[model samples]
Target: MKKLYILFLFACTFGFAQNPGDIVITEIMNDPVSVSDTFGEYFEIYNQTASPIDIVGWTLKDDGTDTYVIVSGGESGTGTTIVPAGGYLVLGRSDDTMVNGGASVDYSYGDSGHTLGNGADEIVLLNTSMVEIARVNYDGGVTFPDTPGASISLDPSSLNENDNDNGANWCLSTTPYGDGDLGTPGAANNACAPTCQTTLGASDTVCDSSNPGATDDTYSVTLDFSGAATGETFVVSTTPSGFTIGGDDPTSTASGTITVSGVTEGTDITITVSNTGDGGLCDLTRDITSPVCIPINSVDLELIGIIDFTVLSGGSDGKAIHLRATADIADLSIYGIGVANNGGGTDGQEYTFPAIAVSNGDHILLARSLTAMEAFLTTPGYNLFDVYLEDSSEPSQNGDDAIELFKNGEVVETFGDIDCRPSSDGTTVTCPNYQFYEDAWAYKDNGTWTYGAAQCTDHDTGNVPSTWTTFDTPCVYPFVAALSTQEFSEGELSIFPNPVSNGNLTIKSKFDGEMKVKIYDIMGRQVLTAEMKTESLDVSSLRPGLYLLNVSLNNLSSTRKLIIE
Candidate 1:
């Protein structure tokens, strides 16, 4: 009788330990593409219970011999690692804060014995007495596929522990975090389940009716009925309206294609399909957000010019130059001058125009290496011109080096100061232009190069963006023009109350003939363009900073510094 009573007590105690769904493994980033696994590997856990749980003495172990004990209340073996209700906890390496793709680590397993498997592994959670609570046996590209530099997140809608073991319940994380890594660590899992899958097809263009030279936009989309029942129907709609759909709605029988028309130029739009089937089992719906645009081609082509340059070492990425086409051009060649860094330097590197065409108002990125540039920007969507320049001919430009763009063997645009400073070896002999450091970009404003903010890229043409302004920050070198040119001083131009505090700046100039007034930020980005019928200009919308005001009349132009407080 005493033996039976002891057995009942043991059963009761085991039942009170932990429930099956109290905690769950939400995300796993076993492999990182940018950095090594030692510094970037991590896993996240979510607490589903309504009250805080003291998880002291809890053991997290992999299929291998590695195990990490949760330390709480400053105790090694017995203490409480209190996890708030409905919160997340990240278990990672000790120095994960330094390299773990910017994930917020709640606890570190240390670096000694904890390493997750990249191919196949098992993660098990246990209570104080070593009783198993949850276990996930995942295999790369199978149970939980591996996506380098991205985490494999479990579907939140299907958060059951039993369903989590299935490979279908897992997906590659699309949530961007940390220095461009993808995952939501120490937070709720991203929604992964899809009622239907939609894909955008190639775009087609026709001549615009409203505009004389613009093109009419048309797009194709394919919708697959994967999670819905047969004979179900869906209604297609688009954001910004005026999108006409052609063809039948999606059904479980096969994938359906729809032609969308009446899209506006230079604007982005989204397409949504909602289930309209009567008495359907599921209200399945899906959306293809932000379709790629088919840019209009143009007859005249002009180099909007280079906006920024990255020259310093140990920067997030390597050197890059931004270019823009005012209008579309076919088979255009862009060659660089003065890129060679030899004892007797010559223009050696040339990027021949590819057979493919560039669209009107499109931005082009030229870099030393496409792979290095993508890794630095953390964006892989940039279309790079594939021309590998020799090391001696690459744009290894300093502040004083000149980079000129050539078209048809003619200099269309030029950047940098040719004779301001000379190169040096940094130690015994230093030059003004050779002072290269990390995170500094040369900004062109009002036909002059100057020091501004550190930015990855600027896609806008003909103007410097506000993102390129970083005033009074250290680690920046100002621009020094060459001897032959005197810009912004050709005309007698002045502004009263130099620092305009009331959002109104008055411009005083000698010439008068319907002067075109343009305002640019310190980075040379034109923010406001208008005709100055009067001397006073309203700058209420502009933020507090330094700006350049360009006043152009008949045959004369002048630039003046404008400060807004």
Candidate 2:
């Protein structure tokens, strides 16, 4: 069996009356709301202190510029409405005719393109007797002088509060702008928005090595090679950067000798190489007989807006939906394909010839710009944007080069044959370093391969090993953990609009057996509880705050946050 709980008429036990002086500005809708209509913004006042005050003839003014007087007919008397102590009252747009729908308000005022400095603004709350009850000059608006200043709300929701302004730290200072670290605001309201930060590119690693095995031989793989975050782990480019190799004179400052560590016989190892600052013919080879050298081809994909995809090749017409990350080169060449313009209604489409499917292992997905892709398709440029990896059914993949094209199921271009060099004798060749090339798939400069274009060739071993050894590493591609033919079960539980409303809460949960639903304030105080099993709770009686809703079964428990307006 299940149970339900309800809390009703449980408040208002004390005979409290709201007094004129008891009204405190609960919130201000605009911290720096632009002065669009001048008489549009309003103030919300709550009766926190006990006593109901007559507000029949009270005048409200902002910054001593705009004045609004409350009236009944032509004469002012006791306030038409008596706000009980601990109650809510709203004052809306000074246009008397516009009544704020059931929402809480104490005073209402609008603005008209009138800019207020980022400093203090004046607010006066008068009583029906024409006497001032609340008078406070709030230090809010755009900042001034040397220090930047903006409004910060007392409550977390950030609704601006003017009266009963007891707490400090309700201001965002603008003094720190233009310091290379903090950017300045454009408009008055812009000061209260979120701030942005500066970040370095993935290829921007310092190449100067610490330890010197010989002279240039001593290199830090971590510093020389780095990888970007993608849906799957794939090689961007098979190139290293920055530091140079020992006893070898290179054109650029950053270059290093190919050093393979942590390798064992009869096992496969993936090595990434990146040339930081120097540009030259660089490749890798396998010496061991037992370990077979596999040629890894870096696959790039481009998609725009929303589009549908199906395999036309690879014998998977209906049986195959291109897995997120799969490492089947032949399959990728066949049905494993990519699409552009998708459904976004963009222009032009470009995708690699072979689209790799998702498997149990890890795979990398590289995204590049259309302009860069066009250059790659038309001209030869090495603008290796970024390499982000994706695995399994993750909702989103890492960020990389973004493209704005369109795709509607038409083979427009082909991913040309990737050329690789061979060592002398041709007996053994360097294994295609997927991780390395994935990092190197950047844009080229003037047909010259850009060095230090970022790569993932770091070794985690404490003491670097001289011999190449294979270790258990994560899959570097998109894959599926499980294939589902049935939908996931909700188990006698349901949540709608996930983020609910304030005051009027509409909850609907169901189960065949008996269940219990309860609501509690953030402080663990049980505000409402019922044993009816399934029903909605009239949360209008609750205050505007964060509350937790707990639904319990025989042994299972689920919780969700209830936001009251």
Index of the highest-TM-score prediction? 1
Clashes of 2: 134
After the best TM-score superposition of candidate 2, give how far the Cα of residue 392 lies from its true spot, in angstroms.
83
TM-score of 1: 0.33
Q: What is the lDDT of residue 253 in candidate 1?
A: 29
Please provide, for model 2 over 359-422, each residue's C-alpha lDDT reduced to its tens digit, 9 standing for 90 to 100: 3222233322332222222211111112232222211111121222212344322221123222
lDDT of each: 0.57, 0.34
Weakest ten-residue segment in model 2 by summed lDDT: 476-485
lDDT of candidate 1 over 93-198, digit per residue (tens) = 6334557667776666656566888888888889887878777888988546687888989888766677788876888888888777888887777877553333
Q: Model 2, which residues run further than 4 Å from truth?
A: 1-21, 31-35, 62-65, 73-80, 94-119, 141-152, 156-565
Candidate 1, backbone clash total: 4
On lDDT, the leading prediction is 1
